[model samples]
Target: MHKIAMAMLGVALLGACQDNNVMPGPQDGRALFMANCAVCHGADATGNGEMARAMAKPPKNLTLIKVRHGDTFPRAKIMSIIDGYARSKTMTGPGMPEFGVLLEGDLVPFDSGDGIQTPTPRKLVALLEYLESIQAER
Candidate 1:
């Protein structure tokens, strides 16, 4: 519930900032991923980024999300992980940084595979869409 509130607040705040520079389309997702995630997740969407060796737990092989999730990509879970609200405090080692910047653009409706029409950050939604697009076969 707390996460939902926070996400809604972000959506409301971002709704007013339409002029902010944002990459909220699949065409721009590759650049967005490179700028923010490539250093950790790799340009190939594999776990073998340059920083992979340094982390206590290696980054995930992003290309295999669907394969790992029973051939169904978990959208809400992945979104929370990327936005930094789903990880627990007891989680040890380094993880992906909270991309607050993703919440500074526009708002879009995302179902997260659920029926609820949660308002989501446009950029974050774009990132999610991009991740889904790169899923490899099991």
Candidate 2:
């Protein structure tokens, strides 16, 4: 009886330890942006967030026409940079945190299976789309 109880407990614990991974949608992207990016990137994606003044380097005005390179805003470049896959001297500052690990699309267990860190590919793509939507035309 004792051995059977222990086996059941172990199985229960194993099930509880499973990683909770969920794919986000466009609304999820907006929520994620508002929660994580809005503090530095602004609610409008304008780069004029509340923390803008405390940092040594001000965030880029993402909506400016001059900010876009060439004829089109580089979407892939922006995504890579946000994911921390791309490194830039200009992107360095206290305000920006490296998000590569968070964006790596790995499933990791959290406390009591209540929380987990999962990749938000859709959210990321949506964010890029949002940025593109707001980019000033040349």
Candidate 3:
């Protein structure tokens, strides 16, 4: 009886200790975008969110491949921008929030093993994937 109880306890502990990494699937990506990026980037990733009117310069139309800098979408560049590492010259004030901190708050149990080990990096990857999915084909 003691051994059985101990074994059960060990299994329970192991289950609790399991990693909680949660990678966003297609649906999760869309949902995440709607909740976080849509407010500024628009529901269609078009950069014409409702808040754009208040700004001096409207947000970029994300679907436009022509407007994208560099030959590729440059995941690092996008990540830097989202992390607030890059600033928009045309826009006044901080163009976007430093989502490095915010991503941690949004993490679900399955998406991040350590909850949010490197939120900015993880969010950058996820956002890049989403952008790639929506990018206009060459």
Q: What is the TM-score of each candidate against the true structure?
A: 0.78, 0.58, 0.61
Compute the lDDT of residue 3 as modeled in candidate 2: 100
lDDT of 1 by residue, 1-20 (tens): 99999999999999777654
Evaluate residue 23 in candidate 2 and report its C-alpha lDDT on the 0 to 100 scale.
Answer: 35
Off by over 4 Å in 2: 1-28, 65-67, 89-93, 100-120
Per residue, candidate 2 scores C-alpha lDDT tens digits across 6-68 of: 999999999888544543334645766777778987888778899987778887787773355
lDDT of each: 0.83, 0.63, 0.62
Which pairs of residues collide in candidate 3?
21-110, 21-113, 22-110, 22-111, 22-112
The alpha-carbon deviation from the true structure for residue 50 of candidate 1, after best TM-score superposition, in angstroms, is 1.3
Give candidate 2's whole-model lDDT: 0.63
Ranking by TM-score: 1, 3, 2
Candidates' RMSD to native: 10.5, 9.8, 7.9
Displacement of the residue 68 alpha carbon in candidate 1, Å = 0.8
Query: In model 1, what is the error at residue 55, expressed in angstroms?
Result: 0.6
**Candidate 3 residue lDDT tens string, 1-138:** 999999999999998885546665445457667777788779998888877777666777777643466546665556556656686666684366555433563443222223444444444456656766787765
| Backbone clash count for every predicted candidate, in the order shown | 0, 0, 5
Error of 1 at 13 (Å): 21
The TM-score, computed over Cα atoms with residue i paired to residue i, of candidate 2 is 0.58
TM-score of 3: 0.61
